[model samples]
Target: MKKSMLAIGAISILFFSFIATQPKIYAQAGGSSVPFLLISPDARMSGMGETGTAIADDINAIYWNPAGLGFLDYFPKQNPFDENEELRPFRQVALSYSPWLPQFNADLFYSYGTIGQYFDYLQGTVAFNFIFMNLGEFNRTSANGDPMGKFISNEFALGLSYGTIIAPDLSIGAQLRYIQSNLTPTVAGQQDAGNGNSVSFDLGLLWKPQNLPYITDRLSAGFNLKNIGPKITYIRESDPLPTTLNLGLAFNIVKDEYNDLKVAGNFSKLLVKRDSLGSDPLPKSLVTGWDNPGADWSFGLEYWYDQVFALRAGYFTEPSTIGGRQYWNFGAGVKYSIFHVDFSFINTVEANHPLANTMRFSMLIDWR
Candidate 1:
């Protein structure tokens, strides 16, 4: 009947959303829910091969490697009598938007926003962020197959993060997230099987050595364990979260008063496992998931001129067996005073790929 059709349609929307946002490869893709959690939020990192764990020194670090916040300084005391008084941006804000799966033009879009404040007492930055994925509108139906009305479908996550330095050269960060999926509401006789909710957390670490022999302050490394939590159940079936382990390294190629260049690389592995029986539990899956044959890797480069303009390029690749998503990303950014704007484009190696030609725009404001 119409109710059954509505459920099917709602499921299709959820499926499509998941497929469109999967920027990397996963061995058992079906074992996870809310794949949007894995999406790269800002255009800056997107342009740089979706790599940021190592160069997470900005506000976007809330989503990349929150530990990077430890390296940032907020508003410092400034006075006419003190010549060494320091004054830097104390509040940070970021926003990003992208039309998801442009190849289909299905009215799908993704948006992100975050704000951070540095507390002098804590000596760290605490941030809160929101992510939303609009899956377009769906036609509501009656038992007779007649259109009754329209309903909007969407998924979102809200998270809080805090990062602080634990040592002179090392930092740690953590995030807590709440996720929700509103695929469809109970209509007619369909019992809202498309709705789901869950919670998760992320842990991250960053290291920037200043006393190393050759590397000194020119190298950075990061590790993040993301989306660790229980499974999400829509109505009956429960699925695991898109838990993942990411590692990255960044190196400064050139640094001077007028020019800056850096290169970064990342390795990511999905830590969710499922088989004919069903999905495995948390700690168990973390180990069993590695038994599967696959991982994803990418590299990126960024060059800045006079601290005002930047050009970026990156390459991303994965095992062919896990839905290989290889592509090149190019982007540009400009900064003026307290504002920064960035734009990026994706060029998939395989022509007509769902992600090809996709573009994202983002902006940031630093306030002192």
Candidate 2:
């Protein structure tokens, strides 16, 4: 146990060292294509400042950290069956929808749906997810500024994920995804607006200790590498995917029969890098980008009453040198029988911010 802790500490030190030594560069934000993929689509997670890499334990884990799925308890030993002996549900589904940048436009929206199922025989869980984004319609015009009608832009991704317990206290998972983006149709005497398609993958790891000297058993640590894939091109110029690395920690502050409180902290850094000559190689850029000033950090707290109702609040910040986004998040949730509903609101600190006053709603169902 001491050795494991020491190893973790060493790795942490090395990672921060890279961050500290990385050179600062001033660049435009939203440089990557399909930027919508980086948005957190899960309402429960978004309510908590989008910091669920370590706290994910429900079907929503399919998006935040698939490794958490391996730890789900579909069947409790104490009451495996009720009086009717109807087998409990091993499958769960969730749907979420949100108005993206509603402060600027109401036509833009995002939607996501996911399903997960546990297989006792395989000692693992499998999940499928879909995400869609509508960027709204834009007026099309000829090179001479003549109106040529209107066209809508859209994006979508489909993914398959699998998770399994690799050790007594460690779990791992992976997800493969196909992404498509359509920005425009075509214009007369101009290059035809084409659709862009690319493939990406996500990898995650989770560690939970059963017992510790002073720490509660609810403490967990997680790491996730997301959106690792080739570049997407809609025209002459190609852009890299929004690759990110996330690390997080979660712990229970209070635990009781009727009351529960949990806290979580997460840090995220973009792995894509750029130089005077443009984008760099993937393997080298991932390390060099560690020092980029775009890192994001968030902290969140949640309280629950009798496992039926929940209240959450959190704060998240990004360096001004990057996008200068800072916001406070508030959320609430209710669970009755096998149905759950969650809602979240975001309030930006800066006045007239494009992301201010955004909202997300989600519904979940668990079935046998």
Candidate 3:
């Protein structure tokens, strides 16, 4: 069966559409493989133009910056509105879903789920996450152009994360993940179609000073180095994982009993290098990749009212050599006792863009 070649082609298409924001080309982000890992899963972060490196405050921190988990409010606080003295959440679970590339209307979808727990003995938070992406159904064909039924394609990842406070005002976190892609099914009488498995890890650090003297402890900074692993192979050809470095800054402009406003900025760079010959191996590529183009950047603002509702807006942009995506994100979120809901919408600058009308929805349950 020639499923490998066709399935391989489809993988590229999905990668570009979902991550690089380019449809026909994989040149962006140095021709990454399994680029789905780069997509921001939670609607809150997606609404913030994927600028969550510094604001990783919820269960979704497992994907943004696990280090934020170390700062979770471990003590169960009293719910003010609950006259029954119900305890507020100290652990969280989140689910995020999106209809990918809705402009294409291809039945494609992506989903993510994560949960976190605090361990007093370990003085840290432990988390787990699962990611799933449906690439839709593909029509199969034989060598003679004969119909050979259809097959569904998909990809998934499983991850575990741990974050702990290493020092005052500082924390460190790590994540390990298993990735798999089922690009095509095996034929009864032929060899298996395209598929692959890989493993990767991430490292992150966050610093939030309580007495910095300048911003009244409102400023925070963080960094995440993600997707550090070996290449993944479908059959013979291998491609580098979408290794990346993310840096972010966040600060509260206003905070009070009834109102809160925060602004965040983020910068990200690809760390995979390739040329006509082949791709450079890890460690080396991390250095050479920087020589190609500038990093992508985004700015976002979030405002919360009485800790019950939020309004968010953000803009993201990148250089032309690096997918050239430019878009605005707007969203709102609501919290009711132990449940939270968030919604986000994308508006692209370019007309008729594949991602022009994409939307994301997320729900969270926090409990003690």
In terms of TM-score, which candidate is strongest? 3
Q: Provide the TM-score for each candidate, comma-separated.
A: 0.92, 0.88, 0.93
For model 2, how does the per-residue alpha-carbon lDDT over 252-309 read when each residue is reduced to its tens digit?
9999999999999999888777655677557666786675666889999899999899
Model 2 C-alpha lDDT versus the unseen true structure: 0.78
TM-score of 2: 0.88
Off by over 4 Å in 1: 1-30, 75-84
Off-target runs (Cα >4 Å) in candidate 2 are 1-30, 77-89, 188-194
The model with the greater TM-score, 1 or 3, is: 3
Highest lDDT: which candidate?
3
Predictions ranked by lDDT, top down? 3, 1, 2
| Residue 196 lDDT, candidate 2, scale 0-100 | 88
Candidate 3 has a TM-score of: 0.93
lDDT for each candidate structure: 0.84, 0.78, 0.84
* RMSD to truth, every model: 3.2, 10.4, 3.1
- Local accuracy of candidate 1 as per-residue lDDT tens digits, 90-118: 68899999998788666778999999988
lDDT of 1 at 99: 93
